[model samples]
Target: MRISACCFKFLAIIFWICPTAIAVAQSNDAQRHVIVISIDGFASYLVDDPKVPLPTIRRLAREGCVVEGGMTVSDPSVTWPNHTTLVTGMKPGRHGVLANGVLVRGGIGVPVKIDSHRDHSDLVRVPTVADVAHAAGLRTAEVNWPCTRNSKSFDDQFPDVPNALDYTTPRLRQELVKKKLLRDETHASFRNSSIVGLDYVWTEAACHLIRERKPHLMLIHLLNNDATHHKRGAQSQAGYTANAYADMCVSRIIDAIDDAGIREHSTIILVADHGFTVTPKAIRPNVLLREAGLLTVENGQLTQAQVHVVPEGGIGLVYCTNPLKASEQAAEFKKLLTGQEGVADVLLPDRFDEVGFPHPRDYRQVPDAVLVAKDGYAVSGTVTGETLVTTFEEARTSYGSHGFLAKLPKMKAMCILSGAGIRPGTQLQDVHNTAIAPTIATLLGLKYPDADGKPLLNALRTSADAE
Candidate 1:
């Protein structure tokens, strides 16, 4: 009974291989670890923002490949859809998460902002890279990544694991508590606490996992930067602080890998969900509808509404009462929105497919028409008598916002990759969001058979070798 050479070598690191042909292949490959860090609201332009010294981010750029043109976020350019797209290699249209929330049957639904603890895995129609990696015998971990609640793709999960926002693993919590990094009041009230405090707790938890569990594939989403930028403009003092804080968080995770003796064996990928733009003007198209008696607000309830403007920052979806008469309503909507101030482009149903939007026939919440705000203008969710156009200083304004058309240069997301088997100091252009999952999956020697993205080969060691 002679055992094969490959089988003997696999037995040496038996823990890494779960079992299967692909797992065997991955175990044979040099790639071992992947730690994906998603910094929400990070724009490609920030890679050179001279305002502050983003030491960690700059280090990554200096040492690894930077996707120069930027990673194009999914349409609507919101959080959850793009995050899901990052892992699944599918657009929001293909992945069934067309937006943060779906507008259903002429009624708007709450966004799936935070993943529910229930088995909502079916919400995503496609399999994530984690699922593929897990199937290939790799342990996966997710910390506060959207659409990952109760997901079977991961073996070790925090935040999503216990239906809690903080990584409340009993031991992990206690360790931070003893270290004076966490207190009961702070941990218990994290949901209502400052963005910095919540992120501090989460970052420590990620470090704990990396130092202890050492998952083969780990994804960490930091929300402080997004929250801060939304409150203060992207170039504001607070925005700089939030981004610097995110950089530090990444540094800690990298340190954890080094402390765990897996630095050389691990691969680190940095990406942002979407970019940011300072929205100086607010447009409330619904205000006009209310004035025209097309919509009614009785005690703040939408009672009689013919059109509902579902505001998504720089973009708005005008939903008609009759999806059956969408064609007719679209024509009216185009004229109605075109006459309104701060409206950049009124995209009708015919342009949905052109802009990579989910066709009306494919989505449950596809709107009659899309309204794009002009540069320096953003849409608001106000359906009442708010002004049609008002300065951000005068209105209840966001210092910054996203969810704009991806064609806008300022809306482009960022991607920085540096790790083992990657071409250091490489700069790739025209990188899209769909290409990410496939590259990560392929690096681990796993097959991303369903991926729509092409593997970014120019940044890889193989590509460098060919060169």
Candidate 2:
């Protein structure tokens, strides 16, 4: 009888220890490494279509939590602002990155660098997910993320000088060398492409970082898709090719992670800063606004007289010189600009006020009135006469553009979450761009300060017992 009782006690202790051991293992397993990939011009329209030939992306969607329509925030929907929004989960208005270039006030141009290292102190307001992740004692790494030159967000960054005109092959190294932009050359590996070689280099650097550093939080931005779209338009074959190349790069990254034995313990997020649209024509709103005596241009410099028509589209950004005369000028301009071609939506400053946007005093980073152009219709340059009325045949240069309203289905970005704690094959609808930061925070069990996005509980697995 004594021997039998001892045996029973020993069995009970074994059962208790077994469950505790499993729990500890599970907790360790949940400490996953997150890899975030942002393809500059990736669109859901391309991802959802099987004809696009993206096998890896399709597989990721199948194996992860895929948000079919991840909405973006607002327009002129350039790269810098949109990329800022993706990590910070804030709109351009909130983040103070209203556009790719800084707003020129009184003929004094505000300096803007694509590299965050060069930004003014007053610009970056919010802490990004990378910052929050680092705060939580997680390792973070970034490669060629936009607005990184003068930024203090990432623990590791490969900064690139921001120059729209410096896209040539020979100029690539010169920009890096002269600017002293990049942190480590080992993180920079060039991949040959028909268009841009540096884009592949950025991807290779990201792969190297993942293999070497194995950061808990990683953000990689690939720009070739956006570059190709800029040159070939959104609907062109070159755009598709660029998208495929980006997909291939993603596959290589995934393979690298898998080979490192971190595949199952890693959560991969694929996002695009914004979608792209083709510009078929250019409409010069400033021409009409200047004609109405609302604007003054002398010696190639524009001065605000009574009102300013700033282009949120390609060409004009209107600013009101005299606040009291805004209504009268706006009324006149509205009358004259009605039925204008290429005009998508017009928002007055008062409308912005109604929407709880910061007052012009606070939101002065942007223009007084924003004019969004319809698909294929962009704003014209400040050049005189004939340039203003150029048809799509003449002005339809860029293969793709974004920065319209985020409410449009076409403008929506994508969000995919996969790995430990995430429910496989889960589909989330109506996910906002604001929700991303919070989701990432929750996955890492970190607290994000003042983040607007919520943790996606639906994407998480139920308790182990339930599973």
Candidate 3:
């Protein structure tokens, strides 16, 4: 058989172009790798601090892009809400995760309780970064990420919730147990495990996932730093030790990525849910509500109440239980809370949006009003205590807290992006926590136009620029 010159040329071109096109496709897949790490209560101010021994975090910041003033987290700067916002790129109002737990209202005069035992579907209303990535045919994993209970978005998940062990992926759990990284598959075992020990296990699990699953998008959260900051102040010696340990954990994850032979292609982003403040004084708002005849207590138990105030660390969510006298009750409650010591500013329903909160009419999780605590003070839900305020020495439990207004400088969270496609040595100004999801979506070449945030274009290197 005789091959014509034109056919031979076409065949040669096809063979030459196919390999180059395949290599390009492989490179694109490699560049799509992204891993998000959330160190709970890791304040951005500590990033450059000499006292805080965060060598790994510091190295990443130097080698990659770092937000100068830190990432300003969403209002009611708590764990679940902020973390949900991190992945969903939506505020509590939009994402529907208003608290660390879901607020359950039990009719009129009954104090609302935060139920932390809810599933991800009930808590997060919007699609997360994991969901979008998975829908786009990318493998995703979540390790100890809050509000991820029973989430089907990720290929692998170890949710951060009560009874976490019960909800962990069975195959991964068995593997971890067999490796002695996890104890028994009981909630009691998980509960009894030390915070530091859990941190270690979560990191190890993430490392294992990276090496084995090689997920395109992985979310990891560590809780030891947050626990330490709550027990001891953020600047306390114990907190420093916790930070150092977290840095080591980050180093381990990096090593795992390297061991997986994906270090060149993998991008790691470090972020935090919220920062911490040393709250030496605790203000019991429920006591004030009681004294004002808004609520009645019997036998140290809340019996009947016209209104209820749920203390969320640095802020109080004031709820008017009686809809009949809602306005009257709200006005009176505001009057009582206005001049109280340790109370900063009271935000009425109208001002909720200013703080990135949804109106109660829009979302049931929202309270009638918000009570902001003064600096160095925290709102307490203690109603039985006779004293309206408790000093640090008296309370003993008063050490640190978050859940403060997002605008506060103390609530600034950390944001560090490193590795593939990230612009090295880039310094960004203060970024919104919501921007994270969009940035991650951009990194993976996925579309998330509904996100309230815009991608951090300055921190990302374009293909043309890379070339």
Best by TM-score: 3
Model 2, runs deviating above 4 Å: 1-30, 73-76, 107-117, 160-195, 293-316, 321-332, 353-356, 386-389, 464-466
Put the candidates in lDDT order, highest first. Answer: 3, 1, 2
lDDT (Cα atoms) of all candidates against the true structure:
0.75, 0.62, 0.85
Listed in order, each prediction's TM-score against the native is: 0.87, 0.79, 0.92
Give the per-residue Cα lDDT of candidate 2 at 27: 37
lDDT of 3 at 289: 80
Better of 2 and 3 by lDDT: 3
Off by over 4 Å in 1: 1-31, 106-119, 159-163, 166-188, 393-397, 463-467
Clashing pairs in 3: none
Model 3 residue 438 lDDT score: 91
After superposing candidate 3 on the true structure, give the runs of residues whose Cα lies further than 4 Å from its correct spot: 1-31, 393-397
Backbone clashes in model 1, listed as residue pairs:
none
The lDDT leader among the candidates is 3
